[model samples]
Target: MKHPSQNSSPSLDNVYRIYWLLVALFVGRMGDLYVLLSRRASTLRTYAGDTSLPGGKRDPQDHNIELTARREAFEEIGLPLDPQKVPLLCILEPFLAGNSLIVTPVVVLILDNTLRPILNTPEVTSLFSHPLISFLHSEPPFATEPEMLEMKYHTYDDVSSSTRPGKVRLHRFMTGRETGGTKPIFGLTAAILIRVATIGYARAPDFEVNAPGQPSQEQRIARALKHDPIFREAAALEGIDPGRIPEPSALRRQVRTRDKRRARSKL
Candidate 1:
């Protein structure tokens, strides 16, 4: 018998030298896609308070991104998924961080979700899950209003005693959380989920059914840019025009004017 786990698949190398990373978007049998995110512990340096997905730099012994994703999931949150049932559905485009790291998101449908995560307190304080659809909705929950996420970072050279501005990006969008989940997902994660929803479901995951009132193509895009701060750079990395990036204010206008809709996105 050929075990599915041993089957070959594409993945980012685990040499540990490549800046590549992997995140798990685990979907359960009930069709509820869960984003396994971790809250950085107080001791961490970067993104100490911000919530991000569960995955990290690969161990040199890890074979591929799939192994890296699973290994990271367990190490961070104790999500022990069976390799036989959990298959990588697709690998989203690599995202570039402000620090120049390329991160890839690996989607896996978990046949089971009973395992509990053992928290690595120094690295991750806790972990949580939110339905994937929360990020797709257009109204009060996800895209209620236009919000600006202007991130300004600076780097200091210890030797020269000089400071230089790092990445300057503005993220404008609505909050994509519901219930008690106040922690919104990072911008790049939202981009990956949007692609997954459109490709796999043929519709945005914002709701159970698509209707006339749903966000138009332009509006949906505007929302995505708002969530992801570095999407523009990511697109440029793929050889797309940076001008295709939409403005945050324009997206706000579209969302506010629900009575009118654009037939197609301008950008």
Candidate 2:
């Protein structure tokens, strides 16, 4: 499986190369396309018991971001590392988490859906699956139980970002107990799927994917690389020059134009 360049421009390669953390969105079809998810072990210090994709920080032995994602998935959920069984789809742009970790989402298609999960009990408590396309809609893929009929499938709030200059949208998608477990998929997880679905289906979402004035993910990431101390330290360790990160305003304009073209093409 070939890993696509994380950035389009050669100059931004080093800037984007410092993605020390990654998550694997294991996409498979069991009728509707689905992505395997896991509940983080409650014993862990950060985001314990929260729902997340199978991934973790890059280890010294992992050769690249793709390998880092696959290795983490294998350790956390027993996902096969064989390229034949699972092949790379595409590497989405990096997202800066509230904790200051620049996480790259590595998407992979699972050719075999029958593979059982082998949970790393210390790192993951349980595993579940959610429809990939559901993230793009306001309703669940199937009929909901009477009690859960009142529950919303997707929602978000316009919130301020400490690292980025402007407001950002924090999305939340409910995956009910009967559907997958009690936890809702929000934050980075929700944002990732919205993008994956948009690409996979080649359709605009039923609702706006971003807030009115939210900065593009690229803009936010560029801001973090330039201004955040933790991101700066990670880049330095990677021998990356923060000076090479594109200006936030330039990225914002680029993203806006690209998004407009996408929206128009869909019409």
Candidate 3:
């Protein structure tokens, strides 16, 4: 069988750096596929009580991004670091977070859905999961949680860039606190899942995924490296040449072809 990592973009191999962080989308099949997630500890210093994936910044001792993701998962939720049990699916391209941290997503499939989670109280308060495909569709999965009087299930907000001219689309999906859910999954977390679902399912979202005029993912990253001193300094420290950033057109086409082939093969 072909490995999941084989489908990831080639450009990911060269972008590791200090400011780079990772989030593990621990996908599992429970009749339907679902993703494991945790709510940040309310007492933490930053982003307290926010919904997030199992991950953190890359440590100097961590040799690779995968290890960083596993280590963070183990620390925050007591998820074991055995690759045989939690094998990688793919590493999605990097995303520039609002905090200026470059976040990379590491998608892993949880082979054992029955494995119990041990939560680290200092970093994570509670753990819950949502249907993986629900990200692609705006409607809530269950009928138990009815919509709030005036609240929308999906919301799109345009965040204007301070360092550049274009705006980035911010997507928020209401989780509806069905049973074991926390707040709405929005911002970086929501955006990451949308991309992951698209890649995993080999289809476009039912709704428009990006803002009408937003730049492509690669273009945004390239612009950040060119115009933001913070990103430039990090790239310099990592010995990455800003001039070598790949254009979005080539990479986008490559991904589209790969997705088409996978669809044909029923992979």
Best by TM-score: 2
Error of 2 at 183 (Å): 1.0
C-alpha RMSD of each candidate structure in angstroms = 13.0, 5.8, 7.0
- Model 1 — which ten-residue stretch has the worst lDDT? 152-161
Pairs that collide, model 3: none
TM-score of each: 0.53, 0.81, 0.79
Write model 1 residue lDDT over 1-267, tens digit each, in one string.
Answer: 112244343122221122333445566568667666677676788667566666776665666667777787777777675765566677766654343345677777665556567988888876766556555553333223223223111111111101211222222223343233344554445555555556665675443332323343454444344344454444444444656666656765756665354534442
Q: How many angstroms is residue 58 displaced in model 3 relative to the true structure, after the best TM-score fit?
A: 1.7
lDDT of 3 by residue, 217-242 (tens): 77676667765677666556555776
TM-score of 2: 0.81
Q: Which stretches in model 1 have alpha-carbon errors above 4 Å?
A: 1-31, 140-182, 204-267
Ranking, TM-score, top scorer first: 2, 3, 1
Supply the TM-score for candidate 1: 0.53
Candidate 3 whole-model C-alpha lDDT, 0 to 1: 0.73
